[model samples]
Target: MKTNQFLFGLKNLDRGQTMKVAIFANDDMTSNIIFAQLFNMSDIQITGLYIAASPRKGTSSIIGGAISLLRRMAFGYWLFLVFTNGAFKVYEFLTLVFRCSPQTGTFYSLRRAAQLRGVRYRKVADFSSPEIAAELQNSNVDLLIIRVGDILQPKILDIPHYGTWCVHSSLLPSFKGIAGEFHALRTKRAPIGSTVFEVTPSLDEGTPLGQVAIQRDETGSVFQHMVNNNIAAGKLLASMVLQAFQCSAPSFELYTPQSQLKSSYHSWPKPDELKVLHRQRKALITPGEAMRLMLAAFRWG
Candidate 1:
């Protein structure tokens, strides 16, 4: 609890401005990481956090922290929404360990995943509730951001002042839905990273707010690609949110999708296919001192 308090203090101070934010998040590490990083640079006043626990656990949970940051909002309120397929498993027998699978994720999982990366959560609410709409109406959110997860209802999507913005895992008009990075990997091609855009009634069909191309090496796994893309997406979203809070003109220019862009949706790989896919991705790692060095670099304290 003390750690959480300390982290929250740091988040508000980092941004150098205060924003009223509500967070809907689950998981642990990812949320903390990025929110923390953003707070380090700006001042954000987090209003509340609503986290729906992943389906693994069969119940929902909520977590909240204070947000103080770099920019000041004359009347800015923010919400970090989370959806998850609730699931929890014990890694060991008696240590109260838990594991969350992709299938068991809900909206909360999205928020949690981001928070685990060091972002602070302010508020939370489950998606199915009428209260969610009421909150959005009252929260005075200037903008809403959606990442990978359940599609928000029209009420929430349309409530924000500037409308909602979303981050698609795949390049727009290209790969959409699940398995975006996988498709790119299978095709032996590297594309731009994340596509940021304003939300419309249709998923992944929003107008492009911005698109950022990532630098990728010749040999890299779709997993790595996803990590790289997510980091970029997180930063992009943060920057936009910052600008919105300040009433500064949106940094995103109008982007219209172009032709010759192939788009497709992919389902998660099956067991047999997953095995093959894993092996293919691992093939890039190869056996070498470099692999060991990489492993040595990424460890938890």
Candidate 2:
């Protein structure tokens, strides 16, 4: 039955009327924001959402759990999460109390937004599962948009008509993997930005679609800059998707190749690196300056 459905979907590809898009993401705030933004677009139809389920803590052995916790703490991840998420939560709460515009970036708020729009959503334990590829095939998805989730295999990557794409939170190939904004902040770098690119079996080596670089505000925390980069990525993805629909064919050839010599991949910071990050926090720009930089980045598009 699934095979027949998949074939039927393929048959309709020649119509090229409206693009069908599917989202692969987690339940984090960034994923929620990307999903909400893509869901509201008129040029593309969001077929379904494939959300990566969090691993069950109870299933892990005591030693494994301890190690995981220790690793996170050693990297100052707990402190980072509290520092970043706390501010957003406070803003959300204040908006509610003041009867102002509700914050839509929260996980629950965006999930509810998706529900209100009558979009189909699902949770999957693995993004590269054959079941997921089958479902996306059956739905006739022309494009796949990945937010904050695991690396996808080629089987899933090749399922969509236009192929898969993702938003990397830094200007690649400079800062390729994980916690890009934090690295930029600690190093006092300029031209902090985001990249929207095609997804490949390789990591962040995919062809670049569009990029937006924001000037670094000297007073902004690493967390605030991270948020701004993500928001900019969401907008850039939307623009790229719209442009894809307007073209005769989705043009993968237009993207520039990433230079490995100039690129660097990063893992999560170590304990000593966290200490450096803490010390460097004093150099971040004020909130007002961060806002100005964010606005400037948006204007670049």
Q: What is the C-alpha lDDT of each candidate?
A: 0.45, 0.61
Q: After superposition, how far is residue 236 of candidate 1 from its true place, in Å?
A: 1.4
Query: Candidate 1, after superposition: displacement of residue 129 in Å?
Result: 1.3
TM-score, one value per model: 0.59, 0.73
Question: Which pairs clash in model 2?
Answer: 218-284, 218-285, 219-284, 219-285, 219-286, 220-284, 220-285
- Give a tens-digit lDDT track for model 1, residues 40-73: 3344544434454441122344232112210221
Query: In candidate 2, what are the lDDT values of residues 1-301, reduced to their tens digit?
Result: 0011122333344445778888877545555554556766787788887665542233233234334645544445544544343444444344445544323332223444445566677766678878888898899888888864367788888888767778877777777876777776676543577877778887788767667766676666765676677777777677667656665333322223344225777776667767777776543335664454334322311
lDDT for predicted candidate 2 compared with the true structure: 0.61
Question: What lDDT score is found at residue 78 in candidate 1?
Answer: 15
Task: Return the top candidate by TM-score.
Answer: 2
Collision count of model 1:
89
| Model 1 regions lying over 4 Å from their true place | 1-43, 55-128, 253-260, 270-301
Q: What's the lDDT of the predicted structure labeled candidate 1?
A: 0.45
